[model samples]
Target: MRRVLAGLVAGALLALAGCTAESPKTDDGAAAPTGPPCLPAASAAASPGPAPSSAGKPLPAMAVRCFDGGRYVDVAQLGNAPTILNLWRSNCEPCRTELPAFQRFVTSAGSKVRVVGVIVMDSRPAAQSVIDDKQLTFPMLEDRDQQFSIALSQVVGRSVASALPATLFIAPGGRIVYTYQGIALDDEKIRALTAAHLGIEVAA
Candidate 1:
């Protein structure tokens, strides 16, 4: 409980005073991490949203380097499942605080959704340190050029005044459902957002 609150506070700080990460080291040609940790079994048949429109906009097709495995993968390949693309930095306090919660969410999510981390505008060492300290096992990617966030702003139609710590919820078939640009540390809140936006119910 205390840990969760700490994360929330740290996330809030990061949201306001964020730091950028550097380009990750990907020259080793390492294999991509096998996959994400198991997600929670929070399945409920989707109630289905209003009138299936043909207007489900797709995420950008940029290629990002996997931070852990040192390989390049297309962003398009990541949205096959209900997905959450969290943009965080190593230097951000909230990111450090919120990562554990996200990791837990991913573990609880099992195969229900894909949660990918994007570390941008921060150095790789700092990012890795936080990941190690937090024991985060989620898949991560690098965004050294800082263009991804801008692209996200355009797609989601939200002014990413401060892009770090942003969470983009992409529904199945690659359409973005919502973009949360702040700290979200509460397990119940995260679960509720997952259930409401992605149609995957995560056990609280």
Candidate 2:
């Protein structure tokens, strides 16, 4: 119990400060890692369906990389379909609780909407462990420098909260229809938001 509380506290601190835990290096001074690769976003070329009302501010022009040291992903191009982008950390209790629900949502969502995750201010190994344990198959990006947070603040026209489990609902043209911060969402809430903001209905 004490360890769990300590982990929670550490996660909160990391989220608020945008700090990363030191990654262990190998004998040859290279990083040795484990776990599956963070998958890429679905094909932007394939049209999910008709576009939603692209009335909101576009996501900031920035590029983030896959969590498994894979290719860079353009943040602004994520709106090939309606999207739910979630920011989380491994040590965060709420994130741990919420990610499985997201996985479930993605499993049930089919091609109607896309769900993406970003590991904010956390080490790749730490984040990967959670992903592996949860069996999460959604595409994940990494925000090591907090550029994503800064960009998000610009979109909101203010300093957004430095909190774990932030969610962004994006439209077809990369427009952000809604942003939910400082709260962990469940499958039901995720579906409701998708329907409300992106006009994509996912069954509960």
- lDDT of every predicted structure (CA atoms): 0.69, 0.77
TM-score (C-alpha) between model 1 and the true structure: 0.72
> What lDDT score is found at residue 67 in candidate 1?
69
Q: Which regions of candidate 2 are displaced past 4 Å?
A: 1-42, 45-47, 158-161
Q: Which stretches of candidate 1 lie over 4 Å from their true place?
A: 1-25, 28-56, 159-161
lDDT of 2 by residue, 76-138 (tens): 668677788888889889999999999999889887788888888888678878988999888
Question: lDDT of candidate 1?
Answer: 0.69
**lDDT tens per residue, model 1, 45-107:** 322333322334678877776666555676766555677888888777877778888988978
Top lDDT prediction, candidate number: 2
lDDT of 2: 0.77
Among these predicted structures, which one has the highest TM-score?
2
What's the true lDDT of residue 195 in model 1? 82
Cα lDDT for residue 115, candidate 1: 78
